[model samples]
Target chain A: MSTATQTMPSVERVVTPGKYTFGRIMPEALKYFIVITLAISYAFPLYWMISSALKDDPQVYRIPPVLVPNPAHWENFINAWKSDNFTLYTFNSVFRYAVPYTLFTLLSSSVVAYGFSRIRWPGRDKLFYLCIGTMLIPYTVTMVPLFIIFKHLRWVGTYLPMIVPALFGNAFFIFMLRQFFMTLPEELSEAARIDGASELGIFFRIILPLAKPALAVVALFAFMGTWNDYLGPLIYINKYTMYPLALGIQKLRAMMSQVGNAPLAYPYLMAVSTIAAAPIIIIFFFAQRTFIEGIALTGLKG
Target chain B: MAVATAKKWRLSKRETQNLITGLLFVSPWLLGFLLWTLYPLISSAYYSFTRYDLVRPPIWIGLDNFREIFTDDPRFWTVVYNTFYYVGISVPLGVVVAFLMASLLNTKLVLRSTFRAIFYIPSIVPAVCSAMVWLFIYNNQYGVINNLLRAAGQPIIPFLSSVEWAKPSLIVISLWAQGTAVVIFLAALQDVPRSLYEAATVDGANALHRFWHITIPMCSPIILYNLVMSLIGAFQTFLMPYLLTNGGPMASTEFYAMNLYRQAFEFFRMGKACALAWIMAIVVAILTAILFRTSGRWVFYGGGER
Candidate 1:
C-alpha cells in the first residue's frame, strides 16, 4: 500500500546524461549539494570554537579568519581548564545537579510515568492533565516564588533548591515517557504479573530493562538541562565554590575582562566550553540514532 | 440520605483497595503539585500585588504595579511592543523555512538521512556559543556576511549593532539554529500518507499544487504546534540579546524578559519583575488559547478524534 503511492513521483521527472541520468541524477546531485552545504554550515561554528580556543589571543580577530592553525597549541585547553576552575566547577555541577537529579528524576519520574501508563488507576487522566497543564505556566512565573520558598526553607545557596525539583518529576518528561510506555504491549507486564511478581518487582525487573531507550532519553535531557543551565545556578548558587560550570564560565569572562591586557585569553574559555560539552557530545555522537529518534518522539516537550 | 450512606458502605473492598493504590501511585505528583506548583503559583500572584524586594517584607501596593506598567514606565509598553514585533515576524518565517527544508529533505532522494541530520545539527551547539558565532558573522568590519555582500555588489549593513536590524539579525541566527523544529517537521512529514499526493497527481495536479494543497494541509497540525510554541519561545527570549546587545544601542533589543530580568536581578525590584512575568505569562496563555481555537479550522490530525 505504501510502496505504490511512493513510486508515483518517480515517473514524471525526466532522465539525464551519463552518471547523472535524468531519472535519478538530478535528485542525487541536489541532495548531495544541499547536504554538503548544510553540514558545513552546521559544523563550521563548532569547528571555529575549537580553532579559536587554540589560536593565540593576538590571532583571535584576524581578518578573513584562518580555518586551521599551523602549529596547534594544546596548552590553550590546559590553561582554560585551570583558569576556569572547571575541575571544581564541573565536580560541583555533577554533584549539585547530575548526581542528585539523575538518581532522583529517573527513579521517581519513571515510576510515575509507568503507573500512569500501565495502571487502571481512577482519576489518572485528570491527574495527568493537571500535571500537563503546568507546562503552560511559563518558567518565569515559577522562578521568583520558588526562590522565595527555597529561601524560607534555608535551601537557597544550597544544592537543594536546584536538586529538589527532581523529586516532583517533571510534567513533560512524565508525559513523554508515559506515551512511550502506552505503546508497549500490556501482555508482557500481564505475563509478569501472572508469574507472581509484585507491581514494584515488575517495575524494577521487567519494565525498566525494556524502557532503557526512554530512560536514556530522559537522562541525556536531564544532564544537558542541568549542565547548560545558567539562570538557575545564577539565582540559587551564591558562594563562589558552590558555582557550577555555567556560572563559573561567566565569572571567568568577567574576571578576564577586568584584568587589562592579560592576553584576553579566550582560547582557554573556548577550551573549557568544549571540555564542559565533551561528555554530552561524545555520548550524542555514539547515540545519535536513539537521541534523534527520542527527540522526534518527545517533540521537544521541555 | 440513608440509601446513599448504605450504597457508600456497600462499595466492594477490592475496589476501595484499588482506589487507595491509585492514589498511592500518583501521590508523588500530587504532593509536589500542592507543595511546589500550586503554592508557588499562588505565592507569585500575591507577590505581584506587593512591593517586595527580597530584603524587606512585601508592602501592599494594590494595583500600583499594573498601573505603573501601563502609564508611568516609559519603556514597559515599548518592550512589550518590541516583543510582539519579534514574535510576529520570527514565528512565521521560522515555520516557512523549516517547512521548506523538511519538504526538500523528505524525499526518495539519495542520502536523505544524511541531509536531514545536517539540517538538524545546529541545535546541538550551545545557545550562547551559537549567539557569539553569529555576533562575529554580523560584524560590520571584515565579517564574512558583509564581505559576501560586498562581493555581490550590495551595501555593507550593520547587522546586530543597528537598532532597526538587531531583532532581524537575531531572527537570522534563530533560523540557523532551528534544528529542533526542522527535525520535528521532518518527522511529521514522514507520517504524511503518500497516497494523498499520488491521488492528487493522478487528478492532473502539478507538484507545486499538490504540495500546496495536500502536503501543507496534512502538516498543518505540526505547523500550528510549532507556531504556538515558537511564539511563546520567541517572546521569552533572553540570553542572546542580553549577551550580544546588553539591551544596548539605545535599548533597541530590550526585550520584555530582559527588562524583567534587569528589574528583578539588577535593580532588585522583585515585585515588579513578578508582575512583568505574570503579565507575560497571561499574554502567552491568551495567545495560545486563541491558537488552539483557530487550529481546528486548519490543523488536520491523522489519528486523534475530531
Candidate 2:
C-alpha cells in the first residue's frame, strides 16, 4: 500500500499486437470511428446547451437548427440572470450551503475515518461495519421522519437542516477516507508516537498531510453533493429566498409561465441552465485527475 | 481465583484509555446515528402502522395503510408498473452502453483522458440542470429534437407531454449520466490480465471469441456491482420526472418516489407515505439479496473462489 499522494495513472499500456494488416487496420479504423461517434453523441447535449443559450429567440426556432450560434447572444445571460433572483440563489448555494457543508464533511469524516483506520480499540471493526451498513438504508426510509424532527426543532426554514448534518460525517465518505488512511504505512504514526507525539498530533502532522489527495476527493464529492442537492433543499427550505441553484433552476420555467412570458423563454432558460452547470464543468476541467481517480477508486473498492 | 480473573478481564487500564480515545474521536458520527438515523428509522417504522397527518398525533392503525397500498390505491399499482418499466429497460441498457463504451476506450487511442472526461462531464452536471436542458431539447415545438425530426420529414413527437413518450424520455435522460459506470467498467477492463487474451490469440481464437470468453467473465464482478447499483438507483428515480414533467399531464411518469413525495407533502398523507417508503426499502433489500445470491453462478473473482 502506498500513500494517498502517489498518483496511479489509470491507463494501462497493452503490448501492441504483432503486425498491422489491412484486415486489422480496417477494424481498427472502424473502432476509432465508433469511439468518436459515441464521444460526439455524449458531448452533443452539452454543445446544444451552450449553443442554444447563445441563440436569440427566432434563431433558436430556425427550420434547420443552427449547430453553432452565429452571433452569440451574450445578452441572454444578462436576461437569464435578471429573469429570476439567481444572484440570491447563487449566494445561497456557495456561501450559505456548499462551502460550510464541504468543510464540515471533509474535516469531520476525516477525523472519524482516522479513528476507525489508525487507532486500535475494542469493537473498532464492528463499529465501522455498523456505520457502513447504514449506507444500504435508503434515505427515503428516513426522509419523512427526519423532516418531522427538523420541523419540531424549528430548523426547517433555516439552512441548519442541510448544513448541520454534514458535521456528523457521511458513511460513504468515512469509508473512502478510512480506506485511504489504511494504505499509509503504520510505521510513520508509530515513529511519531515514539517521539512523544499525541494521537491528535500524529493525525494532524503526519496522516493528514499524507492523505491530501483522498481528502481532496472527499471535499470534491461533498461540494458536488451540496451543489446538486435538490430534494434536501426542496424538503427543508420552503421559502424561495433559501433555494439553492438546483431548486431555483427547477422553479425558473414555472415562474416564467406565471409571469405570462412569451414561449421564447427557452433560450433564456437555457442560459440559466448553462450558468448553473458552468461551475461544476469548470471544476471538473481543473481537477480532472482528482475527479477521475476518485471515481476509479470508489468503483474498485465500493 | 476465577472471580478475581473475571474482574481483571473487564477493563485493563490501557484498554480503557484506548476505548475512551476511540469513542472521543468517533463521537460525532455516534451521536448523529443515535439522533438522526436510528431514531428516525425506528419512528418511521412505528409511524407506518399509525394514521397521522402533520397536525395530529399518530393513531394506531396496524396494516391499514399496507392493505390500501396493496388493494385499494390504483396509483400505487401505476407507480409500481412505471418503476419496473424504468428499471427493467434502463438498468440493462445502461450496463451494456457503459461496457461497450469502456471496451472501445480501452483500445490504444489518442487523448484518452479527454474522451473519458467528455463522457464523464454529464454525470457530474447537476441533475436539475440536466433535466432543464433535456426539457428544452425535448420541447415539442422550437426544440432540438423536433427540429431534427422535421428536417428528416418525420412527425414531431411530444416527448415530455405525451404519456407514450414521457417514461421513455426519462429513461433516455438517465442514459446520459452512465459515464460513472463507464469509468468503473474501464478500470475493470484494464485489470483483465492481458496474458489471458494473448494465450487465447495464440490458440487461434479470434477477437470476438476472446472477448466473449475472457473479457466478459473477468469483468463479471464489476458488471454485477454496476447492475445492483443501477437497479437501486432506478428504483429511487425522482429528480428527472419531478423536474422535467412534474409526473406529467396524466401521471404517465409518476415514478414510485415521485408518488411517495406527492403523498407525503402534496396530499399530506404521512402514514401512507411512511408505508410506501418502507415497501420501497424492502423491495431494494430483496432485489439486492437476489442479485448477491445469483452472482455465485456468473460473477468470477480473480482467485477462483466462488
Candidate 3:
C-alpha cells in the first residue's frame, strides 16, 4: 500500500474507499461519547448523595429532582452529628477501623507474608497453599460457627471479635505481597546473608525498605476493607456504643423505619453517608498515584 | 561416638533455630488463624452435623441437619435458586460491561488517566453508601429516577421495592460497581501486542474483525480468570442485598448467604446455618474445580505448550 501510494498519489486517492474514512472517525467519536456518558453515570449517585444530604426533607423529594440545593443546609451535618451520637460513633469507628486494626494488620500480615515469601522451611509451600485455600472459602460459611465460638468465649458485644481477625494475615493480602516479593531480585538478600546479617535484620533493613510499594498497597486495601466492613461489626459488635461507621449508618436507616407516616429527615442520612465516605475519599486522593499503580500491577498478576 | 553425638547436636540446633524464626514470623497469623479461621472452619464442619442453638450445648445428631436442609426446609431450594439466578445473570453481564469499559479506556485518547479515574470513582464508595443512594433513586414516589420518568411522560417503575425488579435492580447496581473488574481488564488489554493490530490492519481486517480474531483470543485467559472470580463473588453476594432489600418484598432477594445470616443470627439456628454454609462451600469448591478444568482448553498462556 505504501509503495502503491508513493508510486501514484492521485491514483491511490481515487482507488481507496471514501466510505471507510467516516468508519474510522465515527468509532472514535462513539468511544469518546460512551466514555463521557459512563463517567457521568458513575458519578451521578454520589453527587445526588451530597445534594440530598444538604437539602430539606421536602425539598429532597421535589419533582424533576433538584440538582442543587437552594439554601445549603450545613446545619444538617451539625444537627446529625450531635443527634446521632456521631462523636461517640466516630471514636468507636476510629478505634475499630483505623487505630488498632491498621497497625495490627500491617504488623501481623507482613510477618506472615515474610515467612511464606522469604523463608525456606519445612512444609512452606504446603502451608502457603493452605493459606490461599482460605480465600476460596466464603465468609458466609464461617460466620455462624465463628459467632458461636465468640459467644462461647464471651467475646460478643465487644471490639475483640472484629479486631482480632485482622491480626491474622489476610489471605488476599499475603498472596498480593508474596507476588510482589517474588519479583524482587534474590541477589540483594543473598548479599545481606553473606554479610552475616540475621533474617530479621535483613527483613528490617533490606526487604522492608524495598517493599514499600507492596506495603502501601497492603495498608490501603486493609484500611478500605476494614473501613467498609459491615457484616463483622453487625454480627460481633452488638453494643450501640461499639458500632463502627458501617453499622452505625445502617442503624440510622433502622431509626428511620419507625418514624411513621411523616417524612423522616433526608439531610441527616445524607450527612451520615458523606461523613462515612470522607476518609476513603481523602485516602484515595492522597495515595492515588501509588494506589492506581498498585492496582494496575496487581490486576495484571491476577 | 562422641564425634557423632556432637554432629547430631549441631544439626538439631540449626533445625531448632530455623523453627524458632519461622514460628516468630508466623505467630501473629498463626495464633489468629487458629482462633478465628481454622478453628471456626473445622468446628463449623462439626456444627453442621449437630443440633444446637446459641444458648444450648451442641447435640450429637449426625446427618440430621443435612437431612433437614435437603428434604425439609422450603427456603433451602429457594435460596439456592435465587443465588444461581444472581450469579448466572450478573457474572456474564459484569464480564461484558468490564470488557467494554476496558476497550473504551484502552484507546489512545486524551485525558486517559482522568477517564480511568472517573470510571473507577464508583468503586471507591463503600457498598452500603451506594446502596443508600440507590434506595433513594429507586423510590417510587419521589425518586430522581421516577421524576425523570415522569418528565419523559413514562410510567414510574418500582425498582427495589418490587419483587419482579429486585434481582435486576441488584444486578444493575453490581454493574455500576464493575469498575474494579474493568481496571483489571484494562491492564490485561495493554498486553495484547500492538504488532497484532498492525498486522491485522495490513491484512484489510476491520476493527470488529480484528477484535474478534486477535484481541479476544489473546485476552481469553484473563477473561476466564475474571469469570471464575466474578462468579465466586456473585454467588456470595451479600452486602448490597443486605442493605438494599434486607432480603424482602417477601424474601424475593433472600440469597443463600442472606438466608444463612437470618438462620444463624436472627433465628439462632446455628446447626442449620452450618449445614447451609457447608452446602455453599461444596458448591463453590466444585464450581471452581470445573472452571479450572475447562479453562485449560480455552485460556491462552504465553508461548507455552497446550
Best by TM-score: 2
Compute the DockQ of candidate 3: 0.35
Model 3: per-residue Cα lDDT at residue A179: 71
Query: Interface RMSD of the predictions, in order shown?
Result: 4.7, 2.0, 8.2
What TM-score does model 1 achieve against the real structure? 0.89
Off by over 4 Å in 1: A1-35, A194-196, A260-264, A300-302, B1-11, B135-157, B303-306
What's the residue-level lDDT of A24 in candidate 3? 69
Model 2 over residues A153-256: C-alpha lDDT tens digits?
A: 99988889888988999998999899899898899988987899988998899999999989999999899988988888898888999888887887888877
Candidate 1's docking class is: acceptable
Q: Say which candidate scores most in DockQ.
A: 2
Candidate 2 lDDT at B233 equals 84
- How well is each residue in B1-306 modelled by candidate 3, as lDDT tens digits? 787577764546656777678777877777867877888889999989888987779998999989888899888888888889999899998999899888877766678777777677678777777878888888887789998899788999989888899999999889988777887777777767677887778888877897788778888877887888888888888889998898988788999889888888888889889988888889988998998898888777764522
lDDT tens per residue, model 1, B63-88? 89988988899999779878888888
lDDT of 1 by residue, A50-112 (tens): 776777854665544556865678888887777756788889989878788877888778888
Go through the candidates in order and give each one's C-alpha lDDT. 0.75, 0.86, 0.79
How accurately is candidate 2 docked according to DockQ?
Answer: 0.64
